[model samples]
Target: MGLYDFTFYDLIHRNAVCYDGKPAWFEAETGATTDFSAFKTQVDCLAAGLQKAGIRSGDRIGVVGKNSLAFFTLYGAAAALGAIVVAVNWRLSENEVAFNLDDCTPKMVFADNEFGETITSLRDRLPSVDRFINLTDNGPLDAFDDLLDDAPFSGEPVSANDGLVIIHTAAVAGRPRGALLSHANLLCASLHLNHCFNLSPDDVHLNLLPLFHVAGLFMAVCAFHAGALNINMAKFDADKAVDLIAAHKASLLFDFSPILGSILDAGEKNGADISSLRAVMGLDTPETIERYRKTTGGCFYVMYGQTETSCLTTMGRYDDCPGSAGRAIPLGRVELVDDADNPVPPGQAGEITLQGPMVFKGYWNLDKDNDQTFRNGRHHTGDLGRFDEKGFLWYAGRKPEKELIKPGGENVYPAEVEKVILEHPAVSQTVVFGIPDPKWKEAIKAVCVCAPGQSVTAGELIEFVGQRIARYKKPQYVDFVESLPEKDGAIDREAVKQRYGGKQPGNS
Candidate 1:
């Protein structure tokens, strides 16, 4: 079958009966599993139920919850019936959550029982929502469980170009923006990814990343297309991860480096067998990649991309090379452009740009923002990168707007500073950013999360960093928070600024 001809819904339903009774999706904690046949039937029923409820194509349906077996089904059902799936970040504060819901204007919302209070609080503000379905047994709201009671109906013919999902990018350093994706875009991405990995039904994916993000959702869809089993988790818990890996014999797994660090520490301390694991994939800074290789001895694939371009534009194949994020996958055209949008020298740092079928249509309902993000049909990814002598892509850092400019006109990339901080014996995790100051235009600040039973003073850390890097680049201010916030694999810059931006000790 031609890759462009198939929709994501087609892949699951066609294999539903063929892979029926096979474990389609499994939850680690509860040991709950859903077979493909049952899942397909339920998805069809749910789609019909939504259709019967007057939901139609082009309508937005917001889904907010921790990872659950029902989450996948609900997402698929929404897409199959030609409705746009708007997956919300449940971890957001009540205000942030309300802001996004109001901005997106979804026709219906399916929220977890845990978020009932938050949803109820914003009920007065969300006049656009026609239905509110709850994920858990806590009543007073319509139960999502009742969705399965409708007639078993298959997906109707859908256009490849129709909108499928509106994934709102998390506000790691700025406000969240929703990227609209079409059925063709997601299907093409999944197909290319499946082929590149040589995915097979024998493969089992250990998924711990939140389902709301493109990283998690694309991985799940890619695994499904390959007829692979998916072992799902609500969040990344190191101990539970080890148990699930040992139990399921998961052959393929994907997670970010931070999560990987946790898994490695858990293994070293508590001890667990992960012999069945064939490959572990995600973002890996060069140092982290080497450390991961020494510890796991499993094939590691370092991937690089943003949600706006679907899951990935570049990734190195396992066992192909050590540090590259691989050549641009199949259909994608990857380019390195300077500030003026001119091609940079092979080794020179430039913004990584990509154009392909996998790129999203545009940010949902934000016309001016969409125009700015997409240029000449290429998605301008605001990441700095360069090509190696061997033609492997290496991520340098983020764009200047995203960087921390320190006092004395010194530029401090957080990733670079964090890398050096991570090298310190006592420091487990660190985030360095420029905090506003009066004496200096901006002062470098370090907020670190220490390893258990480990302690280091701010002065000691300042001295430690001074000995390693340039004096100007060393943090002038250091704060030890219980935990530095994070979203989408990066530091929570927005939260940090809001909490401790203005009126520092050196304020005017």
Candidate 2:
């Protein structure tokens, strides 16, 4: 059998039957919890609901909401029944949401009440979506609970290569591309975490990362697969996350570098005891990683992978080597390559390319992207990196087209924000880039050339963008220029960055 031989079908069923009373997932805000026994039934029932709704194998179902127990169940149930779960980033603007919905055109979409009006507003543009279920509460629309009340669905014939999840990527040209992850892709990544971290049922995991991204959905479920309790937060708050970690004595944590500070600050301020954490994973500096180890009494874990590769294709639990993303996992191989896909020497910088079961099948409905990305049977990660003398992989920068802004733990593509900024009548042309911020780690900055004789305030432009896209994608700092520097009749991005990207962004 190949490395991609297994699926979660057997593992989930085994865990459900073996660890029947074991806790599966919990939401700290509502104090809602579900055990494995209930989770099994809930997933089956949801699967039956999808079947009854006329959803067949290979059909796509959309979900747009915050982290919750129901969200995990929705994903699990769809995978069990051979339907692909399309996770919509709730932070996206209506138009951005429409583009994705219009792309995959799921048969039914499940959403929280917070987006009821937004979803209703998008109904006209989503021609393929026939049903909308209220995920949080019973409203005028169909309720999620109603789906669970249906007769349980029997397991389907499944394959490791079957599509299970569609995680959208903004890494390509500012447009959202759905990366179709197969069952093997998800399972391999989850199992890699389990194997490397020694995750077990006794572990309590605080899953604060957003589920719309792989970092949240894929990593948290590893704890679930191990029969561990996975605590979720609807929205991130340092105090709340810390309290939950302390109260539940969470053993594992996944968060961005900036968020870890917030959690530590809240914990320290409130005098909350978060000593139970034994493994905290994400980006952090040498000092911060040391602090995390000292504070949580856990090994600080760091790794690198994109939505296209599920999550962590590589990880290292180092007490010494500080900033490395670590070597590629046993189940995968990472190579630094030049433009023509030829491997560069260990010391030389090149594009990071991955070959493993963790790699997603390909982008949904994008043959060209899939072919290019899956060239030579390996997923080409657009990230630039290199291996140190000791073989530790280090991040460099992104490819020209794939520049990303990770503000407040969300991936913000500059082109996507620029697309919305150009939509404003007052704006003529703009170049968006990220700048280092103390709070968000990296905050967005937009350099603009306004229409002749037309005036626009920075606040107005920010508001204009905030309304049209995810608020995090809105530029934290905006600079209006009389005229933008040009190269080959296009805005010179480097010149724009040098001019406007250095200033510290105040809190927005």
Candidate 3:
């Protein structure tokens, strides 16, 4: 049978029947494990619990915490009964968290012990929350274990297009928008990923990305589709990650370059063998990608997608070709279009848009945004990119962010400049943005985090970039910092602007 015939719950159910005695989840730190049959049973109980609590189809339920097998069970359970699970980023500030809680107005929130204080402080603010099911015994709530006592769901909702998860955007431009992904969207994503990553039942997935993000959720779901073992880390511990890789003989790792570097270090330090890993998925500088490839003795797969696309709409192995985000995956059209919604000629940069089954349903409660995103019957990704003559797409930075740094009529993307600055030996991380300039409408400025116990002056790095790209593209001003401010894991440009480019004396 074709995969499109199945829903996410169907995938889980099949895994229980086909791979029943095999391990489905493993927690390295606690040595906790759940086999396929146990996972299916637990999900059934949780779904019935929600149904018993009067959660009807389309009700929004929130789950805020670090990664855990229980929360994943919630994902399946909620989806089974046609309820939507909103995974909240635990790293968000109280105000940020409140913004999401208010936005979704979830009927219930399953949060962990760490988020107890914030929920208590905002208790008066959250009118929609009926109850808080604390993962531990700390909040003004009942225990999560109580849900299993209620009953077990014998049947699931019959719709495949029903919404299942809402993954919020990072709010890089403004307020975060919750991208609603349905069962069809996820299954389509799994179909593309299962083929793109060469996944199989023999493969084991090592997932470290935050579960609140689409990447994390998609990784686990992809494993379930293959009926493979998934070793999901609650949080990345470089040393423990390496040990897990060696112990599980993991085949695939989906993470960023920095985290991959730490794993390589831990493996080297402990003499752990990671030869079992065949592919590592990430995006970074070409040099960084090659370094990771050599370190793990694995192919480095590069892909591009966001919450709006469910997970990844395009992907390719570096070993297949040097660069390029690759052509569109199955059942998708990856393209570059001008502002007029016209397709751009090959090699000309334009906004990247995806038209496919995997595209998300829409943003939750965001009417105007939904219209803007789905205007042309396509997910209009505000990020810019271009297709080569061979049909391989190359990713550019965000359109809004790229629009910020135009100096002297020539566009200079902060990302382009930041990439050069990161190449400097002393620089560890950096942010480049348009700072107001009297001469040029907006001048390019660089804020950098230097390597451990190492320093480089502003002038030296500016000259270094001046040599590589256009002199005008070089950062006119540079500031060295000990650390770059982060929001939702990525560098927060707004926070950096407030801290470094704040109002001067006598200025608004």
Per-model TM-score, in order, reads 0.78, 0.94, 0.79
Worst 10 residues of 2 by lDDT: 1-10
Candidate 2, residues 1-508, lDDT tens digits: the string is 1354555655667788989887888878778778888887777788788887888879898888888878888887787778898988988878878888778889998888888878888888888998998877765568777776456467667778999888887745767789898888877788888887899889998888888888888778788888899898888888998889888988887867787887888889999998898888877656667777788777888788778878876788766467788888888888889998899998899999988778888889899988888888778887899998887888888888678877766788888888889998888999999887766677899988889878899999999989877787788888888899989998889888887776564543
Better of 2 and 3 by lDDT: 2
lDDT (Cα, tens digit) per residue for candidate 1, span 234-316: 87788888788788887676755456667767767777876666677775445555655776666677677777778888887
Model 3 Cα shift for residue 143 (angstroms): 0.8
The lDDT ranking, best first, is 2, 3, 1
Candidate 3, 174-202: lDDT as tens digits? 36678899998888888788888788888
Question: How close to the true structure is residue 257 of candidate 2, measured as C-alpha lDDT?
Answer: 73
- Model 3 worst lDDT run, 10 consecutive residues: 402-411
lDDT of each: 0.75, 0.82, 0.78
Model 3 TM-score (2 dp): 0.79
Q: What is the lDDT of residue 136 in candidate 2?
A: 77
Return the top candidate by TM-score: 2
RMSD of each: 10.6, 2.4, 10.7
